[model samples]
Target: MRDIHIQAIRVHQYGGPGELKLEEIPPPVAGPGQVLINITATGVNPVDWKMREGMLARPLPFIPGVEASGVVIALGEGVTHLKVGQAVYGSVDGSYTACAAADASRIFPKPVHLSFEQAAAAGGAKIAWSALFEEGRLTKGQRVLIHAGAGGVGHLAVQLAYHAGAYVIATAGEENIDFVASLGADEVIDYKAAPFETQTGQADLILDTVGGDTLERSYQLVKSGGTLVSIAGKPDEAKAAAAGIRAVWSGAKSVRAMQEVARLLDRGLITPAVRKVFAPLSAAAAAQEYSRLGGPGRGKVVLLIE
Candidate 1:
């Protein structure tokens, strides 16, 4: 049989957006317990640029993209829950292509109400869910602070925390305070207006999406016995111990988390905000650059494959 080739964005040598090259490559096959998907859209994430810039190393000449939304075209052996032609969305390796094969366990049925772009953007919800509930152990009536509340993960985290009955306090710039509040935040602190530590009260949990100084400042904000969860990097154990608080690093990609997020989406309980859309695969580099510069908050950047 003749091999089928698809146009994809490839990074041969890590450097910058320039490394993202559109090329003709053989499409990945659906291996055991995998599903071949015709990718409709891909979510642009910081990891995409980090991998391209060598911060996160991968094999040379590999495709870049972690999550996407698309239709299943073929199913690998032993996969029974999904069928070909089913619309699904999930984390997939090399999603910056027209077609990519994903592990069957990771992908879930796309919510019917969401556009392909919206589904792609919601990929960050898994991280948000894990951070807010799994790592932070947030509970109803407890105070939870979400840093960067208008960001891709933060926005979702804010809504999830709020709907779960937690007192959701969020940090954002002056521009996004209202936007974050609209998403169910009980309070939105304009971080630029004042030091967040000074403006916010002690919280039962803090979800740190912005690391470095933000994470450093959050230790004092959490009440004793409270938890601080960071997705950007590992939290300092000594600082956490000294503060009498629990600190956790959240980066787990759980299928169960994704499934729960999907249910939320289908029920209109949580909405994914897509900030920008670039098309035709060739725009992968530009999309990454946009995301790197922090494309409009309260959403994610998406790449629409032609």
Candidate 2:
């Protein structure tokens, strides 16, 4: 273990945004099959706040972020694929801090083209790609409708489906309709102005990044034998059976899923749109932004750590 400490946001209790508190904590040791990292940046997702709110239960007082970009500082026993001083990005333990220890297989090389802030947002892209292709089984020449098309995951989903030769339709706020269109969405629907189901009737696939009523309504938009994959919440199986479709709730829970997205990112085929970046000390402000706008803002919220 290193005789050093790092600053990170820690939650001692489950509540709202105010629960996230900045603290000075000891640096973590890399366990076997893990690599220690000096975190450069962290991407804030719905999971972060959700976990803080006790929606996802974890042991209290742990640093919150998981999706991060950083440099390898140390390696654990039996780890061989990566070496010291290499730049990598992936889901890591207590990633809101200045240092982290992450799974070796799950961490990926930071693309030369993207800044650490951009690379840290890779988890969102990977989740979208996994939900659309791996779990949703999106195929070419089919119609895919993405809810919250301008969100952290939804934006990437739109691009991936479009590039995969799917006829892409996306629903967004009226303010982001053109932005979603710029990402190659063939059709854009303003969910506030109209019902998305009316515009996109019976799509082959529907990616639900917005849960609650969105998931419920999406069951109606999928054609028979189609699939509805969700990242926000688990879809209702009875509803899926009633609609003659499959409702899946799974995404990039593994590093291999992130590596696939890294390849696309390195090749410049896809990118994460970062909406706002907060300084390390401004974690509270970042949490407030996420709560005010939710995680589906036009892009993602990131924390810049020096």
Candidate 3:
């Protein structure tokens, strides 16, 4: 019941980047099992823009942001794992703000070696890891292909797949072939230059981030009994059944998945790639730019609070 105010970006009506408005709102209070975070940096996801434009299903007048890095300012009753002043980062409530209140379960200690920008990028890395390793059931010695190899999730997925002892293949623009290769991709296919299905076939697992035609093409590359996991599109179950392959669609908002990501990051086994940083007030403009420059090696776009 303390009086505090913080700057935030809010969307009253869903539309394009121009819809986002920056204004002052009451600083969030730590509720039961929640922690108040003083956000330092927030990551911009494609979903954030989609959510803002009413593309993804959500309530109106919502604060839009998913991943962020910050310090804990307060803890709710029954919270014990975190303390005030601890540097932490995660995808939490309305991340486009100077302060936030998030479930304690979703927060994790920021990696000691990562900067605030890097931590903001790490948010997508965790999701990629969970969708690929945990849900996709990726195994060592398997052949894996990741679409958009230089994207926020794709780059990390490439590294994680390679680190897991998989023969990793990645699809990106010709310009990003070397970047994906440096992340340990055994082969890099230029999706723009050639059809991925024609270049790489019989993948044991496929991590599909780009939906529609990309998803349809991915199904052709997975071997029988293989799994195809998508974060952006719903898997065509009928198509999978016909091809004798398994398909999974990932939904965000899993606490367990977030914790798993934090562990991997803390161990320094995986890292996020950050391409640019924008001030919080400029998040809308940044999102427009990110959408325009869609490709590999562009990395994650982040909004800095301070």
Best by lDDT: 1
TM-scores, each model vs. reference: 0.97, 0.94, 0.94
lDDT of each: 0.91, 0.84, 0.85
**Model 3: per-residue Cα lDDT over 237-294, one tens digit each:** 9999899999989865467777777777888888788877777555655654575456
The order by descending TM-score is 1, 3, 2
Mind giving the per-residue lDDT tens digits that candidate 1 earns over 20-130? 999999778899999999999999999999999999879898999999999999999999999999999999999999999999999988878999999999987899998
The TM-score between candidate 2 and the true structure equals 0.94
Candidate 2 vs 3: which has more lDDT: 3
What residue runs in model 2 are displaced by over 4 Å at the alpha carbon? 1-3, 295-297
Best by TM-score: 1
| Model 3 segments more than 4 A misplaced | 1-3, 292-297
Writing each residue's lDDT as its tens digit, candidate 2 over 1-306 gives 756677777889998778878787877889999999988888877777778888889998767887889899999999998889999888786787888888888888888888898888767778888888889898999999999899888888898998899999999998899999999999999999877777766799999999898888888889999999998889989879988999989856655667778789989899888877887654644654564566545777888877
Model 2: lDDT equals 0.84
**Which residue pairs show collisions in model 3?**
150-297
TM-score, model 3 to reference: 0.94
